[model samples]
Target: MKKVILRTVFISLLIFSCKRKQVDIPIFSYSILNDSVKNFKLNVNEKEPIIHYEYFHQKDTIKRLFFKYNSDKDLLISNLDTFYFNKKTYNSKSLQFKFYQKKEINSHKRFLVFNKNYGLLANLAYGSDYLFLKDSISEMDKKLLFKALFYDLNKIETD
Candidate 1:
């Protein structure tokens, strides 16, 4: 009887240890505006977040995106939107642009998984307050959230 009880306790402990732990990561608020010029912003829940202008354009079904100045940082322009290149610079500053395209195999599946994991409400009634915990967000979502909002831009191809 004692051995049986010990086995039960061990199994319980193992199961508890394997459970997923919730974590609170900074949730980024994303937005786009159109007023004579198109603008985009992604900011954490903070004041005075750094602002940047990123571009995305699709040509012959091949999509590409670029930052005003090529930066390999935590934040990048989302490739989900359409951007038209303007021959103008920001603040009179010239930009050096490098571009990339998406290369994920099951992007649609990944996106659905992301929404499910994150509990993202697409059609929630406005002004609904909820406490959301960020945990186990998939690699695809993380890249989309931080790197680019599109898909695998890491895979390279050449003619």
Candidate 2:
């Protein structure tokens, strides 16, 4: 009986010690896409250039930001005031703001793609004239704007 109790105590202490040593992981990545020339493509029906921003979070803190571009572009832009607490519950912590803007040429077409894991958020296409003249932005201009926006978002620090 004493030997069994000693074994139980030792096991309890081992579990408790392990739990205490568990570290809090932070989510560290965040990005914004803002480039028009290199990050944008025109006249290809099958190819579309994409801008990406990645964020990694553990223990509810930002830890890293990775940005890239790909042919299968997946982008998400959100200004949600609260984040989902669970799969259903909502928790308000702070406000978030992000703006996406793009424009192309007069004869070409431009598309804005956004994804939210479960479904598509936005997949907008516009004619070149409307994108350029109406929006007062060229393809080159669009790239510059996106680059600027991405850099601005990168400057934000989440603690």
Candidate 3:
């Protein structure tokens, strides 16, 4: 009986120890705006919020701007340009410009995921916002917007 009880306790402890650990999942939320220029905004609770922009154009060309907020509510903006050299070609050219205020070091991994998945809302809303902003922007701005947003999304770090 003593030996059996010892074996049972050992087995229980082993099973408990071998159980998998819980991983932390981030909660993400966002908003979209459109009028004259298009825009997208995303916020991850306890983390910074991201904003993107696009302009109106008759041609297929696109211009874009991406930005995020620091703890102090300062803006870090990245401008991007996406252009197609040929209609049939899958490849495209992109240029990137980055601007931001310095802050404490923190991983932006979750932000990347949120951006990639939810960033489309910005594009959809840009036309309406363009009307509201009452500004005509260049095609280059659209391209830059996409590049900055996607690049930031891809840079998310995972430990």
Candidate 4:
């Protein structure tokens, strides 16, 4: 009986210790896409929308980021580049995000986040002009881009 209790306690501690840590990044409230583009396209199918988002950071240096939704509206293509003066090194990362129909989120007010294990919630601001621009991004991509841009933009805005 004592051995059984000790084993249970050890198992519980092991489970708790192996749990993943929750990232504590702050969520911000701001439009993530560029709203002033003159030739942005609007979605025509009515059933889906296209998305386009760009991020620029130029405090001590310059950083440019761009994300675009594919024609099918189920995929995202992102291009990011940054320069560091301290290390005199240039770094870039390109990533693609694909959404599963079952994982999309349709909430009115919630930030979009793509979890590695759980996938992303597809909730975008419905009436944003840049988002509605045809050929830009699908409705789902718009939501994802909003969060992706915000995740990086907030870093610049807050600092």
Candidate 5:
């Protein structure tokens, strides 16, 4: 009876003490992304709308972002990038976001994505772009978000 209790306690401690491995999310960069993926093609096929375009050592998905917004009236094949810490503002608490602006030019197509995890609850594009940090991020943030997204679609790499 004493031996059984000791063994059970030992096993419980071992199980509870072990930590599970966590998947690492890599920082967003143009180099880490695939230059030639079509959002629509992959979005319709996946069980979930989100797709993992970024890989770590080709081993596993490092990070994922909201990849598809399927509104016909609004921007089609549109995606959102992750919020980044605002370095210019010198505020570590402040975050800045980038949006993927998709376009068709001369019948050629390209997909450019760079984002961190954005919650659907706040995605108003799908009637879910809620105010993530309602107190910290205000209506002004939306204006800034649009301005950044409105920039030129893609600046091809000459190198």
Candidate 6:
């Protein structure tokens, strides 16, 4: 009986110790009018969170997003609301771009993922409330809240 009790306690301790822990890391995304740098830090992780970022590099200008599931393959631009990319620069200045598959509403702001794109987001200076508009790479930046919005994985190409 004594031996069995000791074994049970040891097993319990081992199982508890081996359990994975969840941590909360703050992130950010942005808008042009709000140029004051509010230090907005949204968090992401074990619990699902929306991760997003704006991209503006010569030709591949975009406002990217990642919904539910910790990680998922990046998607191609299914639709291009070219009202902002003024034929010269990849600028999204003052334009509240919208994103979704079957939902509605234009986005005012928001990168994403720690394991893969943490460095990039961090280099953008650690925040989702950011903007990166224009051909000049003014790098419009801001913070994005992880709200688990609407997304269609079927549209995204799998890796």
Q: Is candidate 1 or 4 superior in TM-score?
A: 4
lDDT of 4 by residue, 1-159 (tens): 999999999999986665443332222222335533223211111112334443333231243334444445444445532111111111114333322222343553222333222222222334531222223444465566555544542354332
Q: How close is candidate 2 to the true structure, as a TM-score?
A: 0.19
Q: 61-148, model 3: which lDDT tens digit per residue?
A: 3532343323243333334322211111111233222222223324321121112222212221222312111223445654454455
How far does residue 146 in candidate 2 sit from its true spot (Å)?
A: 0.7
Off by over 4 Å in 5: 17-128, 145-159
Model 3: residues >4 Å from true position, as ranges?
21-26, 31-149, 152-159
Using TM-score as the yardstick, the better of models 5 and 6 is 6
Prediction 3 global C-alpha lDDT: 0.31
Error of 6 at 89 (Å): 24
Q: Best by lDDT, which number?
A: 4
Go through the candidates in order and give each one's C-alpha lDDT: 0.28, 0.30, 0.31, 0.35, 0.31, 0.29
Q: Which 10 consecutive residues of model 5 have the lowest summed lDDT?
A: 37-46
Candidate 4: residue 49 Cα off by (Å) = 30
lDDT, model 2, position 93? 29
Candidate 5 lDDT (Cα, whole model)?
0.31
Clashes of each: 0, 20, 29, 13, 10, 33
Decide which is better by TM-score, 2 or 4. Answer: 4
